[model samples]
Target: MRRDKDSKAKADRHALLAAAALQDHLARRLRMPGGPAVQPSLEPGAPMTLAQHLNLIPRPPPLLSEDQWSEVHLRSRLRQDSANECVICKEEFQTGAQVLLSCSHTFHRHCLASFERYSRAKTCPLCRAAQYQKRPITDGQDLFRVKCATRIQAAWRGHAARRAYRELRRHNPPKDERLRKKWAAERLQEENDRLLSKMEDEVGDLDSLFAELDASVAKSREVCDAALRPLAARLQQGLLREAEAEAASGRAAGRLALVESDTVAPAVACSGQQHLALQLGRAGLGVSAGLGAVAGAGAAGAAGSGGGEGPAGRPASAAAVDWDAVVARARARGTQDCPICLGHISRRGNEGIAWLSCTHCFHIDCIMAFEAFELASGGTPCCPVCRSGYRRRCFT
Candidate 1:
């Protein structure tokens, strides 16, 4: 009986200890800050773990600072207006009693008081500005004033934000746009100058080529003239001999005729024959002189036609190009247009005007282009207007 009694006592002690431990555990789980009460009965599927039980505990809402509370009350007190509207209840103020928040929103005094007491964050209903500890309300009118002031503050902040946005938008683009336009203009000017320089270089090259061609043509003509000179001289001499023989034969025949005429004395006839012979001799001399003069004139004409030497014995092609004469003729045409291009001529040295031997004028570039086309077509360069051969004479 004693042994049974001791075992029963030990089991009872263990039971008491187990119950106390469970109670302590329950108390600890329930002791969370702002936590909800836990149920006495455990759910079936799984027992609550310590971590899961702790997670179920609610966290208290964050408290506002004293300064924040003071600011909200001060701004609210200053926002009074006659037309009081309650933002929380969405109703007009009938008793001239309202509350305001630092965010400048208005609400009825009763509504704000209830909201401050119950709201988790103690913030304004409309603007969500945090409210701190409550203050003693002196009067309902003051609350109304605060509400008006808060509304005004909120409106002011909105207005400031809008103004800043507008000002920012207005002032931003001109600097970037000005830079872009300036850069573009500079690039365009550079391109124009480059093109002008390239054109000038091309014109210079063409002028040099024309000069070389003129020189070559002049040399070829000189060679031809030199080759033909001896032949021309021999031909002239043969012509002179033929003319002399013809004159001599005619003189002899005239004298014989004078002798044969049958009406006179011998001495008179002899004198008449002598006078006829003298006249015939003078006529033959005149004929010979005339032949020489004719031959000389023909030679001079051929030399002139073949481009004779100019001043200082320079070839005609090597002589100074008569740009002045070309200009004058171009002006006489009464229009600034080049006949070949039918475009206005600049008369500037760069325009490269060339004049034909016939004095017809064209732009040098135009003439060169046409000549190239003609050469490509297996033809020679000639005057478009007069169908005359082109001569490289009037260029500088």
Candidate 2:
């Protein structure tokens, strides 16, 4: 019985191996026709998948928001007038929509539609005022007020003239022609004097508006600086101290800590002893409002005189700066050679030269050479201390 079971097991194992070989032969036959080959049909510029095609084409810009579109339309109408010609299309204005500007220039409504659509800031074709609304540097209403006042005076004169004509007709009832003409001339002169007085008052109002605008912009910077000074000092003491310490370890030690010890260090001074502070508290008092200080510019007008021009009038604060001494000290403190020349300016050979107030001084011959080079480039030839652009009379 044991011999018979062993024979059956060996027969079952041989049958299983034969079946496996048959399956492998069938798989090989199926794969043999293709054998790892792949075919491709896509040509150049052919449409890809939906995602690829969408990515290949450039996307248009985002459309303007509803509020922005409305603003553009309003601004366009405000800037152009109904009767003016469009600069772009050179067309006449139409009734349903005429573009009008704040400057009183007018244009055809449709001429600027595309410009308003795509441009970030569409300007009036004539005056170049941008589409967005801006606060007037001076009162805008004052201009219209002046116009209205002039028109009122004109209307009053016209009415008075007609009354004078009627009165002459009533009294004389068609007398000699010379008498009627003489009466008309006398009435016109009387009307002119009254209109002139009204016009002068309107002019005075406009002047006051301009004065206020100047005062606002003039005081803004000073107020901002004064408010910021304390905060700036705190930041410099805390956040900037580490950076300053690191810089001092390097070559910049001489240029640090010039400020009043409590505030920021001055740029020109290296140490506390070298700092210079000059206070001019009288500047704002009795100041002139003009661009440059005019001693008493608006004395006749209602606008109060502006503050003095102050230290700003000086060229880069160099009028008060002692450049020659600063350069000598900087050279003495410097371990490196001068930035302009490779040679050490601290040494006797180069030390004889004095720097100008512009902080660009060099040897006399060096200035001449620099001037020649500047002339060749067609740039202003200024002194090295203040970089004051002056012509060099002699060439090296």
Candidate 3:
């Protein structure tokens, strides 16, 4: 009987050990990373494990409950003011068409219904107040709400973006327009002053240039007067000699006319003597005038030579000489063209003939025209062929 009891105890102990070993093995397999999946199939009378029972229990719904929605709806209606606009739709409040949250935020009924169904969290969109309790939401009503909310939210977002942009523009800082204008005026004034200064400098330079030119002209006149003094003295001596020779010639002509009066008839002799006297008188006058002019020119030349006053004046005979006649006489010797007009000298008339001291001849009209052109072009009248300076009277 004791052996029978010992055998029964051993059996019970072995069974306990085996059960413990099986439990240990199952726990190890479950904890392993790559362990094969153990899917136990339960028989009709088998009791479920804790994990299986937990898995079988139903999960709470993801959306807001009917009671919570109804409470939200009731609150929204009570707080709905005609003056207030829906936050989601941005439309004026409709008496029973809006939802007011426990957090004092209001939205359109359709907007709130959609938020509750599609929102990841069961909280107020504005205040973030959580919906703790839940109830079933009907599919038909939720579907309609989601569609309406989608359209409203899109419009609201666009309106918000535009409003924000407008606010930013209105609050922007003003530009310093007055400062910019002041700077522009200052720059203009500075530029004007700079130009004025430059013009003043140019004016001063021109004044100095004119002063120098006047001084140079005065000095050149003195030099010319000094150089002409010797020539004037020679001209005076030549004029005195010519006057003596003319007086002697007049005496000889009167004697010859007297000798001829005896041989010819009394009427013819009287006429010849009268003619001879007239000719002598004219010759004497010419000689006297020429002497007077030479004396005056010599005196002026001598005075200017000492004081460096001005250029010497030409002798009256020199000034009165018919240069055109001399040129015509010279042209008769050779067929020469006028340098200015580039045409052969015309013997028919003296209208266009001009003679220069340098022996160069030109058409009177051409030289006069050229002189006027030269003066207009800021140049002195000079010989066009030789570029030599000549007294302007030479052309006359």
Candidate 4:
């Protein structure tokens, strides 16, 4: 009877409600018979935390923290709501006797009394709470709110996950691995072929251009050589004529030396020109007489000695220089080639004409280039035509 009263008092004491759900107190350290108090660490490994060492289990859900429990009236909520039917009696609330526990589950009062009388323990059949508070009401408002919150959270989280999935899709590569590599290889090969073709075409064009230039040069050289042949023959003829004239002059000098100053030989066998000189000689005196005498003797020698005539009908003794005629021809040939540069000397522009003391003419630019070449070679500049010492003057 004493054990039964103590058990009833213990059950009543455990059933009272607290401000919030009561968590189990931490276990106290154990003191062995041979040593001081020691906290047990049943778990293994280094740097184990106190909870991990104790190996605690997690709390049940709705898992509200102590700070989050402020608005909730634990006792009032327990009294206000419970299951509509009693689980123990298997009857509805109107079945004459019903009980509400702190866990908000319902049971019949006589059913609990009969259960406690026959059983040693006081566990509630509905929730299996060993001890709990009783109230007189039943409600389902909080349960409904929890279910709605769960559904809303689930929907929101699902939407967020779908959005994340779409964003991740952007990372997918357009081509498969093998195809991407194949395309890269093909591009490389095509570029190489294009470059090789371009290089070959350029080389062929370069070779053709060089061949054309070489042919043009050879043709121009042949034309120049052909043109020079007639000019060469003309030059040779002029040189021979000059030599003959010099010989005639020398012969005239020799004959003049043989003539007597006072005697007038009647049978002079002279031409009209010789007779004129003889008359002048006889009439004149001193140096004038000597000049006339020499002239007459020269005319006689020239007429008697037989020689081929040069150029036109003229006395052989006076071989008038071909210089003036050549200069006039050059001036008339306005677009004539320069002897130095082989470029034309035009009369209309800055180049106009330039001349040397030797009577050689060329374009001003050509003369200047020739002068530069001579200066570089450390030699005196000269006319390219006659090779005479150059004394240059410009017309424009």
Compose the digit string of candidate 4's lDDT tens values, residues 1-396. 999999998877654422111222133233435533334332222233244333443322233344333223364355543334455656554425555554545566777778878776666676687555454432344445566799999999999999998666444433788867766676679799999999999999999998998888679756754554444334324433543565556543554432322222322212233343444434543332232223233333333342344333222332322435546765675536677656556656634466543456776544644443343344555556765442333444
Give the range of the ten consecutive residues with the poorest summed lDDT in model 4: 17-26
**Candidate 4 versus the native: TM-score?**
0.21
What's the TM-score of each model vs. the native?
Answer: 0.23, 0.21, 0.24, 0.21
lDDT of each: 0.51, 0.41, 0.50, 0.48
As a whole number from 0 to 100, the lDDT of residue 342 in candidate 4 is: 66
Tens-digit per-residue lDDT, 14-58, candidate 3: 778666655544554366565434533332223443334444322
Model 1 residue 143 lDDT score: 51
- Candidate 2 TM-score to native: 0.21
lDDT of 3: 0.50
Superposed Cα deviation of residue 119, candidate 2 (Å) = 99
For model 3 the TM-score comes to 0.24
Clashes within 3 Å, all models in order: 10, 27, 2, 3
- Name the runs in model 4 displaced over 4 angstroms: 1-179, 243-396
Candidate 3, run of 10 with poorest lDDT: 261-270
